[model samples]
Target: MTIKNSGKFIIQKEKLIIYLFVLSVVFADILGNGNLNLLYFFGLFLIFKNLKIQVSFLKDMVIFFVPFCLMILGEIFLSGNTFSPVKVLVYSLKILVCISLLSYTKKRFWVVDHLTIIKNICGLFEIMLVISLLTINKPIFWRLNDVINRFSKTRLKFLYSEPSVLGILCGLLVIILLYYIFDNKKNYMLLKEIVLLAVIILLTFSMSGIVYTAIGIIVLFLFQVFKNKEVIPRRMLTYFLLGICLLIIILSTNNPISNRFFSMFLGTDGSYNFRWSAAVNVFRKTMEITRYWGMGLGNMNTPSGLSFLLNIGIDYKFANSFLYFFTENGILGIIYTIYLFLICTYNCIKSSKNIRPLKVGVLAFAFVSQIAGGYYTDPILWIMYGIVCSNEKTVIN
Candidate 1:
């Protein structure tokens, strides 16, 4: 084959790897639930086959893993709480592999025009969501009271574990699409994708998705408004009217989405309240037991103590990522995370101005990860970080 053909083949291969890798993670619930995600493993395997390990990346790993290992060992040896050695091992491996894969993908794909690949993936999910909506009320498509229901009606999860999970995923995609739309001078299709993703998020009735979407919008709007003074007062007025319209909808509509948000503020929403309170309770209990050090890695199980806490009679991790980090790794972990975050933020500030949307998107997702999502091994979080930390001189388009 000619050199041009070889180049085309390589690009196609990269696109394929990215598509499969992202799809596996997105459908991890269906393919592999719990600690053992089949698709996640498969994705990592693909990454390893293609990934070029760098000395700098290895050094960064040491920075992350040393503290992680210390936390795990501390939990096993010092903390008198019930812990699982298998979980510790599995979680550690997953985090290492996930970060490695993300770093590789960022260098190979995100810094290039292969970003069209992500947009294509977003289109694929958008199609699935549209189909699910079209088939609403059908046998399997509309199962009522199955995990996440809104007023006895099935919320659109689209084959993911639950609506919240699906919503979070959609929210991330929406942010990416928004970035694409903002960066590109001519992006009519990107705009449509963001709109569809937003609709899907709303249909899921996930407060997390709604919040993430709002944050993304605000971040992008502010960045654009400051970058270009032309949109100042008109855009501000449009946003004000938009917010008012949203408020009116929430107040007037008696649907599950509206009710859920209302209950959330009133502290009556079970999911919202439990997610927040449980993480806090776990952190508090862990601190009390370990004297604020931590309960160690993969050791989020609440010990038998106060009966008032929202301890569901099962071994579970905290839904909040930051609290989870503190509960597991303590002060050192918090310091490390904060330091990493600052570095990432600084890098983003120094990067190209066109990629500001992605910087904001990553930051928004990071906030949502702490509140509505957790687990150190979450690939999406690492993936966003990788993309944002790509070559500073590279153009995202």
Candidate 2:
């Protein structure tokens, strides 16, 4: 085909890709159902199609791929699954794919483009949160309960069987709500909307959600201080206020630092504690057994298989996600896992510089939430990183 024909075809294809993304976002965000989760295809297409195949993005990608590589090695060295390397590599690749799509889409669109669609859906959720807060049980209403109930009759389910998954989704929602409050500065009318988002976040009873939000808030304060070094007084004043608040929480906890802070609200079942303790136990076992590092890759799979072990870890039946994945996966596991996180973090920072500092700051804060052991399964977490990293350096005149 001629260049003109190819160009026209590409333009049409791009439009379709963007439209698909909007559809997927609505399905996931507003509808609150995972039926559209399959629409990840559209997301993949948008990224791969527009991917900057040049080496310009090589440095950014290297930062991303490093952790992924290390995480795979750790998994292999510890678990030793038949598909250790492949499994680890594929998982890591998925993350990079999302990052690519996110950056590519942002470069091709306006700042507020996707923001508007997402905010609209969030607006609905926010309203539900407000209504629930004012009218229902402890302001904890699952707005999509009816939809979820109906959808559950078949295979479609909004709330997954996985607690961590729920936690991850809740984390994303909290970030979006904050994005409105901090970055967009929604008005008094919208303030209620954002407040509702906060309420919904709390209702999820998700440790990941709560922790990430808290961390994001802390980062936002720092972002302000660093970005506006010239106007340090105001930023520093806010920072000081936050510091005092955080100090109170830290000093008052009863359990171990991580447990007291993270699992208190996960309820008194001791489930959270049990899982975390198991992680420590695994590490302890490794310490006793392995004179050098720990278990090798693919060890966790065992006769039980990798999935079962993960489920066990999730319910706190055996271990927590961090300890189980790292310990059984071993020393390499921890390093690689952290590496993927760092790469994602680096990309977010790079993107922030190219756009409005505030947006970058908001995204950077979101990333910090993840690095601090916020759950990896959260779609919002990935979305936030993808959007921020992809456009880390867009030039808008």
**Candidate 2 per-residue lDDT over residues 72-138, each given as its tens digit:** 6554545444455554454555566555554554455353455455556565555544564565433
TM-score of each: 0.83, 0.61
Any runs in candidate 1 off by more than 4 Å, and if so which? 1-8, 50-52, 55-63, 70-83, 112-115, 134-143, 146-153, 183-185, 228-240, 301-318
**Alpha-carbon deviation at 64 in model 1, angstroms:** 4.0
Error of 2 at 324 (Å): 4.0
Error of 1 at 180 (Å): 3.4
Error of 2 at 329 (Å): 3.6
RMSD of each: 3.8, 7.7
lDDT score for candidate 2 against the true structure:
0.49
lDDT of 1 by residue, 265-356 (tens): 89776676567876777777767767777756655543432221334332554477788778777766677687667767876788766676
Considering every candidate listed, which one attains the maximal TM-score? 1
